[model samples]
Each structure stands twice: as structure tokens, then as C-alpha cells.
Target: MKIPIAIVGCGGMGGRHLLGLKELASSDMNNITLSAVCDLRRDNAEHLADDAEELLGSRPLVFDDMKRMAEAMPDLQAVDITTDARAHHLVASTALDLGLHVLCEKPLALTIRGCNRILTAQKRSGKYLSVAENYRRDPMSRLTKALLDAGSIGRPELFMDISASSGNQIIITPWRHKKNMGGMLLDGGVHNADMMLYYLGDIDQVYARIALWEKTRYRPEGDGAVSGFYQRWFGEMPESIEATAEDTLTAVVNFNNGTMGQWTQSYAAHGRGFGHKVIYGSAGSLRPGGTRNGAPPVLAHDGQDEITGSPLLDLVPDFHLDAITSNLFGADRLASYDIPFPAADRKLLAIELYELAACVLNGTSPEVDGFVGRRAEALCYAAFESSVLNRPVSLDEIESEQVGSYEAEINEELKL
Candidate 1:
């Protein structure tokens, strides 16, 4: 039987999920039935409903409230929670209470406690719950992990990610600049942090310095643009609002393997936007973010030292590192896993939808469960604490409730 599903929050991310569902239904995958699309704005919901009509020859029920939608579609087995990070817990908990499996967007919630609430609700309901961490499920990410397993870069020693932005705020949802949404890290950097975990495993410790270098006052978006990322998505605000969340963050992540990684995120940066996920290993180094530059996604170091300029060779673009026996070994290490082609973000969402259905039909656990999502969120919080406290904060310290930041504000925002 086809899984009855709903797409909540018909915004940018939600639209992506909608298209993904279209792909599944159009392809005769029959994996999901687009039972509904819910958004705060009636137009957004109706728009996607029309798009579904065009694509699947059927329109889903439109809703502005999730609880009412759940009550209307009692048979809905799943819901894709692409609402704002701040409202994820509210929508997800409501869906869980309705006995619907949930596929929520990244960070799960603005605060770890919010994530815990959803997690607790999921446990009580005994239903499937997954976080839409597409970065971890992306093809490039999979290739990078396979290469790491293949030891193309032996014993990872150092890692770095520099995500500098130009006109970044133009794409940002205004609420992201506030304390409740955790400013930059929770709003966007969760993807970066989650990718780090995907590559390096769990973080052992974190020492971070977060700051708002540019006090550029941006008024809340009014009548959002329609063609760009920020289009038709940002929440409406009264007027001239100032944000308190940090706009820039520099963090040092210590992985359990004794390797250290440096991460820098800035939404206010300009002049030659730069970003790449580079890992320096004992034998060689590899850069996986090259696909953005139209270069091979997987490149191995040709020299002994990572610091020195070394020509990257054996661009195992297909992730078949073992096939190139002349250059490196251990391709078989990743053989246990499949290497899908690099797909669009929307395609990744579609893939997640299939997985969510599988979890219910096969009686399985979600790949990125709530606990995993919460930990990633905690790392973001730990960064905030490190900055506010002006010292390194251990993940355990934050997880054990020994430390916390923005909890009161997040509680107020979510009315916890």
C-alpha cells in the first residue's frame, strides 16, 4: 500500500519536498501519497496543491494548521516537517501524537530541549521519526565517507571548512538572526556540523568563538522575493528589528579519533565567497567539496604533507576508489555501501521520503533519528556557550545540562 503523507510548511524547503514527492509519484514509485500540504499561508499551501495537481493529476488537501490537518487525514502515516526550525518541535510533536511518522528538517528544533520533547513524544507514540539531514545522505558526502574508509587519506589528522558568504542575508529567513533560531549556527550551520560528524564521527570536544562582526541592521522581510532562496519563505515581521544572535562563528572541533577540525561560518562575509571540506590525513589529504567548483568531488593528495601544495590525483568521481588499484587500496571498505550519483537537494528529500516509508513498512529505525539530530543541535549550542563563556566547552558538559544557552529565550519563543 502507498504511504499516506503530508508536507507541512510550504516554503523553500517544503517546496523542495513537494517536488521530491512529485518525482516519486510521477515515476510510479508509489512510495507516497501526497495527502496534504500545510503552511501558515493559505496561498503557499494552495500553490503546492496546484503543483501537485499538475504533476500527479490530483490535488492534496491544503491546511494552515497541522493539528487540524492531522485530524482531517487520520490515515496519514507520515508527515514531512519542513516548517521553520523554531516550530519543528510543535509540528512534529503534534504529528507524533497523531501516530504519524515524521521527517523533520535539520536541527530538529532551535534548542536541544525542544528536540528532546519531540524525541520523547516519538518514543511515547512508538512511531518512525527522522531528521532531514540531506547533507549526510548526499552523494558527495557518501563518496567522501567511502574514500575515508578506503584510506585514500589515511588516518584523518586535520579537517577544515570555511563557509564564507556574500549577500548571505538576502537568502536568510529573518528569524534566523534572532536568539530563538540560534542565529547562524542553528539556522544553517547545523548542516555543516552534521556533515563533520558524517565525516569524522562524533565530536569529542568543542572550543569555539562566535561573534556578530557586522551590525548591519536588516529589517524583517516584507513581501519576500519570489524567485530566490529567501523568496516566499521568510516570516513577516512588524518593522526595523535588530538581531541578537551571532552572525559569525569560528569553532575548533575535536573528534574522538584525536584529530582536530576547524570550522568557520559567516553570513555577513563578502568578497570572494569560499568554502570547501578538506581533511588532512596521515598518508594523504582529500577535498570533497570540489563539486561546487565543477571539479571532481573526490581528490586525493599527491604529496606527503597536507600543508604543502600537492596536486590531487585519481579523482575517483564515481567513488570507485578500489577499482583504481594502481593509486590506492580499500575501495572495498565502502563496498558494503552503495555510492549513488550526486543528486540535487530536492532529490535527496525525495530519497528521505522513501526511507521514511521504509521505516514503517520494514519496521526499522530512521537513519538520522531524533537523538542524532539533537546532538548536532547541542554542538551548535556548545559553540554558543564557548563563545559566551569565552572558553572551550565539552559536549558532555552541555549534554548533561551542566551548561546551556538561549534556553530561556527559546522556551519563550516556543512557549515551552
Candidate 2:
């Protein structure tokens, strides 16, 4: 019996899920089906439906409205939501309430209150809800986890992560510019923050500073670029847009395990170097490569030898679009190759799919559940609070009705 899956928001991320599900279906590892898909645009939904039908040999129901799709396909066991951060709460809450397991894209919500609402919905429904914090599941990241567990770095004492962009050329959807939709920190830094939490433990306190870059340019009113053809089709002259949200943020976080950590994210840096994270301990250090569109290097510090060493960890092959097609249609059924996606973003997509599959088959909630999502979102809020007040904000200062229970669970998980 294949688990029937539905996807909402047929954007790039949504299309990626459809592709992954099609691959999984062809693998026949676990019985899974793409039962339905929904998007706000009829054309986008139809395009995905065409792809799904060609790949799966069974057409999935496509609807412009998610609610209509859910009603039409009552057997939908799980849904992958790739909508904007602002709509995450509404879409995820509806899916969970309807007894469908949900895998929502990152940030969880723009506001802490929105995150809490999703958590409340999850608790009430008792349905599985997982955020697509995929960086934690990347092959290299997995290796980092294994090394950390194996004590590659002895007692991770100090951690630093730096993420700088050469001015993001985002195709401006209005929601992206809106602070309520979760600006840069909530939109981009959520992944950075989540990865930090995964490597280090829970944060005890946060102190931060935020700044907006005044030089970036964008059209005042136009849809964002599709590919590299922004200037060709839109004909909208780029004008210096006032950055209402922070373009750069630097924060110091105190982890519960007494590790001092610092993270910096900037969208204004030039010269094209990717972001990097280095975890240091008394004995050795581990530094993972930047988030550029290339193979990431996971290097370990050998304190005994007093040098950094790169072990011959097998590099996962990069599967092209043809490989994706073959994996779906089975012209040449190669053994399931564990190819690594380029960066954390794609790996996060894979984890979301796996979590949805798990929820459908095993009836267990995802490891990164709604509550965990809220915790991450709350940390972002705390960072903002710390910046505004010019003081470190303790995790305890963020008031949630469920904070007591949340802290207890976190404490138990950390064995603190």
C-alpha cells in the first residue's frame, strides 16, 4: 500500500518535492504515491500535474486552492508545503487539522505567535508536523553529526559561523519585502540558526546587532526575475530600494552546555565567497566548507598531529536531471545511489520528503516537530529583542504558554 502524498505551492521548492517523490516511487523502496498537488496559480499546478502524470503514469489531482484539493483527495496521508513563510501557518495548520501529516518549509512562521499557533494546532490534532530544516540532514552535515557523536572534536567549546551573500538578487514577491512575512533573518537565517542549534545545544541567551544596507537596487513594482532574464522581460528599471529589514545581523549565543558561539549573516558582501561554519573544542576543531554551489569539504583538526586532516570520505555523486528522469521511469534501474545535493537547501528538501514518508508509514512525529520549529523561530525573535534592548535576552524571557513544557522536553533531550 503506497502512502498517498499531496504537495501544496507548486513553486521551485514544491517542484523539487514532486521530483523527489517521483524518484522514490520509481525506486519502489517504499510504496508511495503522488496523489495530488495544489498551487495558487492554475498554470503552475497544471504544469506540475503534467510532470507527475508523465513520471508516475498516474495523474495527480491538481487544484488552484489547497482546501479544494484536500477535500477532493480525502485519502491524502501527507502534504509537503513550500509556500512563503507568511502562509506557512495557515497551510500547515489546515493540513494538520485535517489529519494529514505536514512537512513545511523553514522559518515555520514569520512571528513567534504564528509559530505558536502552528504548535497549538499540532498538539490539538496530534498529527505529525515537521519543518523542512534540511541542512541538518545533508550528507556532510550527517558526517559532522557522526564525527561529533564520535568525539572528533572534544567537547565543542567555541563555535563560529559566517554567512555572507554578494547582495541577493531575489525576484521580489511582495511578501518577501514585507517584514510580517519574515524578512532576511526569518527567511534566510532560520536555516543558519537551526544548523547552529543542531551542532551546539539549545541557546541560553542571545545578543545581536542588525543593519540594513542602503545600496541594493530593485524595481518598485514588478514580479521578481524567473531565471537570469530579469531585465529582458520585466522592463522595470532597477532603483535603489530602501531595505526595511536587516541586511546584516551578527549575534552571540550562549548555549546551555556552556559553549560560547557567534554567528554572522550578511547579504551585502561582495567578491563571491560562500559562508562557512567552524566548530572548535579544547582538543581539535571541525570546519565545514561554505554554502557555495559546489562540493562541501568537511575537514577535521588533528590536535595530536597539530594539523588539519581531510579523511578520504567517499564523495556522493551528483545526479543530474537525466538521473532524476531515469530514477522515476526506470529505463536503466541503477541501484539506489545516495547522491548528495549541492548545498543545505536541496538536502533540506530531501529530509522533508523522508520525514513525510516516515510519518505516513510509521505514524511517528518527525524529529524536528512543530515545537522545535517554534523554538528556532523564538530564537530569531530573541535575537531581534536583544538587538532592540541592547542586552542579552535569556531563552526564559520569551514567554510562551507552552514554554514550561517545551523547556522540560528540551532539558530532558539534552540530559541537562
Candidate 3:
């Protein structure tokens, strides 16, 4: 049965989701119909509905309110929430309370308490809750996990996920710079947290120093400036805006499995920027590719040329993408793909949407379910807690709210 679904929050990510829906429809795994698009902004909702019509050959009903959309469409089985970070818990709790499955975007909620609120609602409603974590679904991520599991990267010793960007410009949206709104760390760092968990394992503790290096951010000067996939931002923007969120962090994380790594990210590095996700094992080292870039993993031995591209596939002969993911991207056993930007983004999101549909249809768990998402989010919080305490903080303490000085303000604002 095709599940009737609605997409909440018709903004940039929402538009990309429409593209994802189109890609899902093209694949054999498609199982959901875009019945509606909901957003507080009527113009945004209508605009995305128009794009949906052009892409999917039919326009979805537009709503300025989610409750109105739900009341209007009794058949709505689920919702894909692409709303901003702060609204995730509210929308997800409401959707679950309404007896509908939910696929919420990353950082599940702004704080652990907020995440617990949604989790509590899901428990009460007994509806499926899937976190829209697309990074782990990438082929490179899948193969990397396989190689590590298969001992290709024997006894993984150290994993490093380092990223440094130099810019005072607005990152996608203005709200992202606000601490109460999840900020750059929670909004962007959740991906890194998830990738770390996916590549290594559960994090035990984190010692971190967090800072806000760039307090003032500037918006793009002219129209046609791109932020993410396609032209996400256009027209005139504010000259400058004050940022409250911490933009820089350097942390040493200890994994539960005896592995350790550093997670350093900054938006205030002025001179130069670099990024990499490489794990060094006893036997060799493997560097995985980006989430949406479709680049292949690079494997290096002591005296061997780095193996990547098609040859990288040979390292993990038993590695393969699942049938659904394989068909969605038109690749199954291949190590790397060359799918371009919008398509790559769409395909990954489609995989998320399809997983939500599959769970609703088949009673299976999602690859990135609520608990997994909560853990990824909690790791970020752990870093913040560590920063505030000036000491290493355990994941248990962070998850249990025992150590929450950093999140106290956000939790107070949210009152969750």
C-alpha cells in the first residue's frame, strides 16, 4: 500500500525533498505519495507545491498549518519534517500524537530534553519514528563500515574527522547561527557525530573546548548566490547579523570500543580550510568520502599506492549496497558513483523517505531510528558539556542530563 505522506517545512531542504520524492518515484522502491506540503509561510508552501507539480506531475495540497493539514487529510499516514532544528520536537511530538509515523530531520531536537519529549511521545503513540540521517546511507559510508568490519582496516586504532572552514558568511540561514535554534554545531555537527558513530562505535566520553570565534556574520551581497544544492539563497540579504552560537570546537573523543579520535570544526578559521575523515587501523588506513559529493574512499597500506575508485571495491569484495539503495542510485556492488549534486542529494533523501515508508509498511526499524539520532545529538551535547565543565564528560552523564551546564540555557528557553 502506498502511504499517504506530507512534507512539513517547505523551505530549501523541503524543495530538495520534493526532488527526492521524484527520484523515489522513479525507482522501484517508491511507496509514498506526496499528499500535502505544510509550512507557516504560505508563499513557501505554495512555491514548493508548484515545484512538486513540475517534478511529480501533480501538485500537493498546501497548508499554512500542520494541524489543519492533518485534520484535512485523515489518510495521512506519515510526515517528513524538514522544519528548522527547533521545530523538530514540536512537529514530531504532534505528528506522533496524531498516530502518524514521522521522519524528522537531524539533531532530532535542540536539546536532549527535547529529544526525550519526542521519544516519550513516540512511546505513548506507538508510531514509527525515523530520523532523517542521510549521511550513513552513502555508498562510501556503507563500504567503509564493511571494510572496517571485515578486518580490511584491522583493529581500527584511530579515526579522525577534522573539518575547518574559514568564513564569516551566513551558513545557509540566519537562524542556524542562533544557539536556541541548534546553531552550527548541532545543525551541522550532527552529521559528523552520526558519521563517527557509524564508522567507529558508541562514544564513551569527550573532552572539548568550544568557542564562538566569529560573532558577526555577513549575508551574500547579490542575488544568485548559492549556499547548498542549487541556488538556495537569492536576492538581497541583511548586511550583518550577530551570532550567538559557538562556531569552533576541538574535542578528543574516546569510543566505547577502545578507539579514540579528535573532532575539530570551526567556521572562524580565516586563512585556510581543510577537511578529512580518515581512520587508521593496525594494518592500514582508509579515508572515506563526503556525504553528497559521491567521491570514493582512499585506502592506503605501508608501501601500497592508495586504492580508490573501482579498485577500492576489491578491498571489500563482500561489501554491497542493499537492493533498494542499489537500485535507487543505479549501483549495487560498486565502490563509488559519479552521480552529480542535486541527484546525489535527492537519492540519499529518497533512501531516508523510503526507509520511513518501509518501516510503516513492513514493521521494521529504520537504519537511523530515534535512539540512534538521539545518541548522535547527545555526543554533540557531550562536547558542549565538557567545554562548560572544563573536563571530560561521559555520554551517560550527558544523556542522563547529569552534566548539562551548556544546554541549561537552551533547555530553559525551550522549557522541554
Candidate 4:
């Protein structure tokens, strides 16, 4: 079954989706056909259309408006909504009403209310919808999750995921600095939030402290005439820029299962870095001892002879996701529930998009559906509120109150 689909927003991420879709169509498992590509800018949309034609031997229709795209291609089965976070709800709602399934980019929407708008539309339309969160879909992440589930760690008690980087970390994008889209914590942090949710489960409460360590503004500073490449500005030399987002954040979370999790984000770490993911469990501890992806996850047990699995023997670095995928989809069909995504290279984004396409084709719920996306987003937004209120915000507090401070600001600013 082929799922005819159009891609919206032909910018950075949208372009990636275009490539993935083309790859999926050309692959042996070929299941999705790219029918059209859309961008707010015509040139961007047309450029991807040309690439699609070159890759697939047929040009996809191009449109500046999504409704126009759908109207133009009445047979379009679904849309890969790769627009900005703020525009996700509006675009998805329109597509949902038009009876198109949606595979939206992360955060689903900036505010909880905004997210619910898409959910309501999906409920009314009965269309398949999923959020493309690819972090946890990566091979390494999946391997870690498997080990945890296999009892390698023996009841994880605590987990710490930290990322410390230099330059291009803080100024993710010009609009990100302006805070039109969320910020570092919500915009970039949504991936972290999803990863946390994958391992730690639901968060019961969150307490956070946020900071704006490096106040930045988009400025033209290149050659004396201001003609140098600026990575922070997405290779653009904007004359002026304003900031409203928090760049540094630290948060502690209490899970409903009585486990604790901590997350820290800092864009101001210019040189030396300290970053790692360590899960301290009752029976064993795991630390990432090396930088290469080929290195196996380090495991150290407190000499517990009863738990007799050798770490090196158990956690081999060479086992790819393909091994498991091939088994589940090809050999061990009924014995396993794992979906064999076609990309043997373990391209996480392609895996995620393939999952969405599979759902639309086979009539199954996506692994990361809209509800999962919203819950992860809620954690990020709730962390924002916790930072402001200087206390742990319970999940019930977020559920009881229809609109939190962050949600209110987003609705007011974006007029959602």
C-alpha cells in the first residue's frame, strides 16, 4: 500500500523529510509517494519539488498554502507537517478538517491549549496523527531502552542526562532568540523531554530554575561591512534581533514510580564541557566511558554474583537495530511486536517517518502518537512554570488549570 503524502514547510527540517520520503519511496519496502511539497516561500517549495522530481522521476506539486496543496492534490492521503512549532496546530487543524492524516514535528504546539486544538480536530476527523520525535528512535537510544527493559540495570533509581556545548548552542535560530517559537528549553528541549519520558516514565512533579546567561541579539557583524558567515543567524546577517527566551535551565523531576530524574541545559559553556547520561540502579551502574558510537555502554556492578551476566558479553556494540527489525518483520513475525522500519542505516528520522506512513497505510496507531507528544510538551512547559513559581508543580496542577502562565503568554503572543 502506497501512502501519497505532501510535505509542508521546506526549510531545514522539511527538507530532511523530503529526502527521507524520497528514500522511503525508492527503498525495497517502498510505501510512501511524495505528491507535493509546500513552503510559505515559493522558491523554497519549488526547489524541493525539483529535488523530488530528480530523485523520484516525477515532480511533486508546489504550493505556498497548505489548503491549496490539498485542493490541488485531492488524492493526497496525508501530510508531513514540518512547519514551525507555533504553526503546527493551525496547519494540522486545517489538514485534519480536510480529512488528511498528520505527522507533525515536535512539541506538537507551543501551548497545551494549542495542542488540544489539533487533538480535537483529529478526534473529529478520525484521521491518523503522530508526532515525529526521532531521538528515542535512534539505534543507541533503543539499545539502552532494551537493556533497561531486560533488567540489565536492575531497577533504575536515578538518571542524569546533561549536554554542555559552546557557541552555536544558545542562538539556535534568529526567531528562536526572538522567542516567537518557544525557547531553548521548549524548542530544543522537547527532544530531551521525550527521551526522559521514554526511560523514566511519567513525571509526577517538576521543580526548575531557569536563566538567561548570555543575552543575545541578532546583529550585523561581518567584515567591516558586516560580511561574515554567522552560524547563529542561520547564515543570515540580520540588522537587529531581540531576545525573550531562557537559554539555561536546571530541573529535577519526581516520577510517579518513585524514581528521580534531573536535566540541565547551558548554552554559555564556551570551552570545557561536562556531559553524560548515567543511570544508577540498585544492582548496577552504567556510564558512557567513551565518545565513539561503537563503544558499548559502560556497566559496573557492585560484585553481585547472583546477577551473573557479563556486561561485555551482554551489551555488544555491534548489534544494530536491523538485527531486531529483520527478526520482527521477516523471521519472527508473530513472536515479536517490533516494527521493521526499512532503513538499515538506522536513520532515526526515516524510521520515524516510515512509522507514520505505516500507520496511515495499515491503519494502526503510531508508536509516538499525538498524546505522547503532548505529554512530553506538557513536561517542558510545566518545567517553565516551576521555574517561575519556585516550586514543584504537580502534574495535577497542570491538568487542573486549563491555562498555565506559559500557555497564557503563548496564546496572547501568537494569538492562538
Off by over 4 Å in 4: 167-172, 217-235, 288-295, 303-346, 399-403
Name the candidate that leads on lDDT: 3
lDDT of candidates 1 onward, in order? 0.72, 0.65, 0.87, 0.71
Candidate 1 stretches with Cα past 4 Å from truth are 167-169, 217-230, 233-241, 290-295, 302-343
What is the TM-score (0 to 1) of candidate 1?
0.85
lDDT of 2 by residue, 1-416 (tens): 66787888876667667666655654545456788888888787887888788877988888888777778887888888887676787888888888888888887865665667788788899778888776665444544555565666689899888888746444343244445456776677887878777877788889988776633546544444443212233443344444556667899989998889888888766678577678888667877533322234354566454322234132222222233223332322221224444322433454457656766676766768777777777777677777777888776676353333223332333332
Residue 220, model 4, lDDT? 34
lDDT of 4 by residue, 1-416 (tens): 77888889877667667666655655577678888888898887887788788878999888998887788888998999888788898999999999999999887987777888899999999998899887665544555666666667788899887877643343534566545577767877888888888876888888988877666554434433321112322445455555677777789988887778888877556788777788888878765322113234556688753321234434544434653233322421111123234343234556667787777777778978888998888888778788878888876576545438756777887786
Among residues 3 or more apart in sequence or in different chains, the pairs in candidate 4 whose N, CA or C atoms overlap within 3 Å are: 222-226, 222-227
Q: Please give the ranking of all candidate structures by lDDT, highest first, separated by commas.
A: 3, 1, 4, 2
Q: Against the hidden true structure, what lDDT does model 4 obtain?
A: 0.71
Candidate 3: the clashing residue pairs are: none
Ranking by TM-score: 3, 4, 1, 2
Please provide TM-scores, in order, for all candidate models, with all chains considered together. Answer: 0.85, 0.80, 0.97, 0.85
Per-residue lDDT tens digits for candidate 1, residues 1-416, read 68888899887777777767765564434468888999998998898888788877888999998889888877888898888888888889998998889999887887777887898899899988999887665544566676777777789999998888734343445566777665776778888878888788898778888877655545433554433434554455324456677788899999998889899988778788877678899877778743212233445567544421112223334454322111111232232223233225445666678778878887878879888888788788888888888888887777666787647666776787
